[model samples]
Target: MSAKVPASPRFAYKGDRLKPLRAFCQTARLGSISRAAEALFLSQPAVTLQLQALEREFGARLLERSGRRISLTREGQELYELARPLVEGLDGLDGAFRERVRGLDAGELNVAAGSSTILYLLPKIVEAFRATHPEVRLTLHNVTGAGGLDLLRSDAVDLAVGSMLDVPADLSYEPVYRFEPMLITPRNHPLAQKAELELQDLSPYGLILPPQRLTTYRLVDLVFQQNRVPYTVALEVGGWEVIKQYVAMGLGISIVTSICLTEADRERLATRSLARYFPSRSYGVVVRKGKYLSPHARAFTELIRPALFEREDYYANGQSER
Candidate 1:
């Protein structure tokens, strides 16, 4: 009798080899097999079998269970970080391929930006992008603070264009523009007429500023505190336009970023460089660490700054830093 042929390892299991990894990934993410099963449309038993096969294949425990909850082991966490992007990329491959074929003529791009960025920084970029890719649907989420970060982490928006003083490890910030810190007051204000301005020079005046929660307020406070210069906030408001208007109406002198200062603003409000006392604010593209940017998203970012993320590592491992 002829010797029995050996079974090929590749065909040992049915369907895609990726099924086990996908199952494992979902289970690891949801932390409950039942929830992962519900998400994957597979029964809990099937998911369990897949996980078992995956652990056997890797010869390491990928997960640990206590009661009904689950968590990844150290090995599992490392694998998750490496495998997640691959899984996500494959899952999006079909749509991505279609978009590639159709080009920018058909697709949607979502961006998150605060009101100031949307108003000042993105206008020219948006106008140019719209003129070029008018058919593409673009939505800008006007968000700030934690809201914008939440959208980015959830992949609700493709990327964010705004200022970031503190960047999280899971996100990447590429600051392309830097604006000087400026002190804005009504044209006739005494502080505006000073040949030279010092941080202590404005301590007597109550300042009109954005809410204390904003970075501007915190940065200003930090500087003043560092110098032992006491300052006061006369009014807490939102929006650059509103702050400039309030300052123009002589409510109080305010410290502002030059990003929002225009020719009209310069005419209405006398502005002096506070760069000596304050650091320049940086604005740029913010993306999730391992996000796969759609072509529409990539195109929009290119308009903001040419050849942005052209390096392989940027879209590849999402490890690129600027």
Candidate 2:
């Protein structure tokens, strides 16, 4: 019997066993193994293996895959409901505690913003912030409108800076900058010759629009609908740069934020400020409702709006930062 002592298991997971659940939760929240890996600073294979471990431990498939998209299964949803808050709380605990114990000298700040804002808006502000606080790590997520808001909900990002046409109930938007809208056309276009362009003037010409689901298309739809104007769509493209290129090639004219009109863009196309036709779009910071802000987040946000962090005694009041 003394010779029959049981051998220890060949494999072992020593550190926090909850890690598999944490990786699984981030995968569920972001719906992509690659993205979850990026968020966790782990290899994609590591995240995939952790997910496999979770599914094997529970004896169920936790995820479902479409053509290119991954979604949570019913079992996955149930687990996520219980696991998301735990993972967020555990990961956020360090930043929250450190900021309270010390100050803005340390901590991490992650931000999400749309492509237009990343390309045209954030360079200088981010440079200024980094110059002031090189110790604080800053990451800017270049995501689309819908994707950025989704990242905000999962606590993957501390703050999101972009334009919002429709604000969700669970999110708060604070406008910081207003930019005029401009119509872009080839210099030879008949409409481009007009000193003043009207809604009716656009009816006959082909219009290049962003995809229908995006807010850009929605705003264009609203303006045309209000004026009872009928328009033709020549093409539906994704980025402002591509749209500009097509317009330059004489595909069709497109409306864009004036903030994107660089001198280089100006030489290729003519622009007329359409402020009279469309209200200036606002770009601002958005945060989750009832969320806590780390000192790093507060310091960076205060840079965006001096009044934003001034009123909130984040430690004492803890009143909603929204």
Candidate 3:
């Protein structure tokens, strides 16, 4: 009698290799096998076995474990970087295929933006998008910059719309709008009376600024420090509307992006361009480096700015500054 062939090892065949790779990618991303297992709905031992299988298949040690922390080795890092996009693409294939079949007539598009952007910048564009693609389910997530970035990275949102002071390596920012910085004070305040104002002139008046952790506060701090101008904060609060209200009440003067300014605001508060002191803020679309845009997403982005991703070198530069 012929000897029977031994059963093949699990995930040993080329076609079946995706299983191990998926496990490894998830583990690397979470930095913990247990968390990866939880995300993948697999047992910890199973995930560990899959990782081992992947390492063996590639003939390289792919992970280094210390206490509760797990990190990728040099070879693992290189492999993870190369394989992540492929894995992500594969993982999203079903949804992408469905979106393609549905076309722009139907599909969900999630966009993340801050309150100011939702209030001022996106109103017209959003209205236009809804008019064109009323059937598409569009969800707008109002979140801060850091929160928006987190959502973008986690694939919770298809794109983010807002101002970015610094661009990360794994993300691309393409600016579509620019607004000058402005200093606002009560209409009758001393600074508002002058046709021209100096930075030092405002030092005596207390400033109403956002929280210290926000970009606006930091930018204002940086400018004053560089110019050696001493300043004080009269109030720390959130939201441009609240700040403007406080300034109008003569609590203190404030610096704000012109994006939030309106004709009505001018009647209550005297506004002067602070472009010389602060850089103009640019608002745009931010996306993960290798994110695949769906038909609904593409349609919405096009409404914001035509051909937003036509160029292949779009991500080559961190951002296009105007």
Candidate 4:
């Protein structure tokens, strides 16, 4: 006969107490007992009681009330800082658990990307992933490259995809592709007839440039700075698509990545190689250090890795072998 085994001690009550802690944190964060109550679906008195209980447990006043307003005490501020992540992590855990119960892969994969990735790459990548794992939902946060990296560090996003320039040391990156930048102008523009172009050659025309913070803008700036080329920037826009649209309208000449130009753009505009060598920008996948990746996210990464880089090399090398 098998020996009888002792059952584990009950820990459910301890875990369930997070509900009160969550309510207290929300009230502290929002600085209004009524607002916090509404947010947590509890009465004002209930939220007040929870806050009082938390303060009692810590043996200090956590909040101070003045008329209709509330503010955190010094100790409360510290506790609030600590509690915010705990609450967020618990929420993430709840989401992961629900997904698991629904016969789907658990955990969320938050992706941060720029407008270029959203417009050009993300749709195809997301579609392909969803076809195989229809139930795995992906959340995309679109921001500038710098902002994307900030989100990744803050745990707002699991991964970021874009140009790899000025990446932070705490993150890891895998190169996806290297794209050549091209100068685009209206079909009737004088430079359209040129076989090749340089920034100095295009100095006579107004240039529609991206904002200073964007990787594209930095790439263009580096080239001009290195070559000592002087030109007039007619406009500075935020996104590639917008820049292309402005260029198409004969607004001004603009430099853009070759991949950002579509067939429609080609038909409407003329593109020329820079007379001097402009450095190609490497777009890559970026993830935070030591963060957990869901199985579905890992699979998606595997799919994108080959689709973006390896297969192209295989075919190119194969043709050369022939």
Which prediction has more favorable TM-score, 1 or 3?
3
Off-target runs (Cα >4 Å) in candidate 2 are: 1-105, 305-322
Model 4: residues with Cα > 4 Å off, grouped in runs: 1-107, 306-322
Clashing pairs in 1: none
lDDT on C-alpha atoms for all candidate structures: 0.83, 0.80, 0.84, 0.74
Query: Which of candidates 1 and 4 reaches a greater lDDT?
Result: 1
Better of 2 and 4 by TM-score: 4
Q: Which candidate has the top score in lDDT?
A: 3
Best by TM-score: 3
lDDT (tens digit, per residue) of candidate 2 on 1-322: 3578788543233256678878888888788999989998999998888888778767799999976778999999999999988888888999988865664355678899988888867776787788888888899999977899899999999999988888999999989866677788897788777865788898888989999988878888899899899998999989998999999999998888766666576467877666767777787889999998887787777676543233223211111110
Candidate 4 residue-wise lDDT, 1-322, digit = tens = 9998989554332456787678868878788889999999989887777777677667798889977889888998998899889988887997877765663344456788877877866666787888877776788888875788789889887778777776678999887776666778888887887654556787788889888876667777777788788777899987778887898799998887655755466578777755345766667788898977667668777676555553243212111110
Instruction: Tell me the TM-score of each prediction against the true structure.
Output: 0.64, 0.62, 0.65, 0.65
User: Residue-wise lDDT of candidate 3 within 1-322, one digit each (tens)?
Assistant: 9999999565544567777788889999899999999999999998898888788778899999978889999999999999999899999999998876775456778999999989877787888888888887889999997899999999999999999989999999988866777888888888877766789998999999999989999999999999999999999999999999999999999998877876578578877777778888888899999999887787777777642222223211221111
Cα misplacement distance, residue 192 of candidate 4 (Å): 2.1
Better of 1 and 3 by lDDT: 3
TM-score of 1: 0.64
